[model samples]
Target: MGEHWIDVLPVFSDYWINGEVFTCQVDPTAQAQVSPWWQVPQRLIDQLLKTDPGPVIAQALQQLQETRADLYGRFSPALLEMKIRHLLVQSHGQREGLMARIVTTLESE
Candidate 1:
């Protein structure tokens, strides 16, 4: 189910960050074989964008899933954490230092 990254946004086509890695962060410039299937909801996005520190993944993802299963979908919190870590490591473009640390947080036991 995983393969090389796609560097170009297909014209007039639908794509998803969960299914593809955009190497440039905003666009594609290189390649990685995986994508994180979940993203922070708006509330969490705002929290994560803060400079000091982001919300704890162990706590946050669970809350998101439990409260809004219809939006984020049902996913394993631990696996989601691992997926995000893999994506960030493979294609973070050296600009997501805060996020790297944030995602590296331990998953819930």
Candidate 2:
């Protein structure tokens, strides 16, 4: 299956699936669709948040650099990169909002 971005946090009442794109408590089956990223195994998300994301990004960049030889002629590199970066920015904002809700929930707990 492919991935799509979801902008909302799925508490007991709301959530996301890997393929579908909506947030509602209306479906009893909604819980099944929650993404693995959001479910976050054994609640490691709390521990992960304590660390900076900088090193993660750096490692990703390094990996991409190392794989550059294998990535030649994949697409219109310039246009694809621009579009992907723009989309990533938009997704990042959406993720930020979702995280805010999650953090609020965690704090209140």
Candidate 3:
């Protein structure tokens, strides 16, 4: 059998630059146990990716990149991605998830 990005569904790695968290792109072709693969929790997978949140997330990300490149460039892709994912899960309510956690962590750094 061969491993793919889908096989690693949501694995990631985080780093910091000027206090913002950034997710490093993990090589999905590599073994799961290799570096840069942070096994995301089932809970987050449910909140962010389950039930095909693709359309909503894709729209949000695209719009942001197009309309707000300056601000977008200020933040890390991982942080921006997390913020959009959080919006999808929370949906006009109190948002809580990796984005919140990372934001809190970043503020402290």
Score each candidate by Cα lDDT.
0.45, 0.41, 0.57
**Per-model TM-score versus the true fold:** 0.24, 0.24, 0.36
RMSD of each: 15.6, 17.6, 15.7
Candidate 3 lDDT over residue span 1-109, tens digit each = 2434434444567655469775667777965565545567768666665667765556555666686565557678777677666655555332345344434433444
User: Top model by lDDT, which number?
Assistant: 3
Cα misplacement distance, residue 94 of candidate 1 (Å): 5.2
| Candidate 2 wrongly placed segments (more than 4 Å) | 1-42, 46-51, 69-90, 93-109
Q: Considering TM-score, where higher is better, how would the candidates rank from best to worst?
A: 3, 1, 2
Compose the digit string of candidate 1's lDDT tens values, residues 40-105: 486655545343222344444555466555433535666766654454445532224534343344
**Highest TM-score model number:** 3
Q: Name the better of 2 and 3 by lDDT.
A: 3
**What's the true lDDT of residue 67 in model 2?**
50
Q: Summarize candidate 2's per-residue lDDT along 1-109 as a digit string, tens digits.
A: 1233343344454444567455544566545555644544544643453343443334333444455433323434454344334433455523334333433333343
Q: What's the true lDDT of residue 26 in model 2? A: 58
Error of 1 at 11 (Å): 53
Better-scoring candidate (lDDT), 1 or 2? 1
Query: Which portions of model 1 miss their true places by more than 4 Å?
Result: 1-68, 93-109
lDDT of 3: 0.57
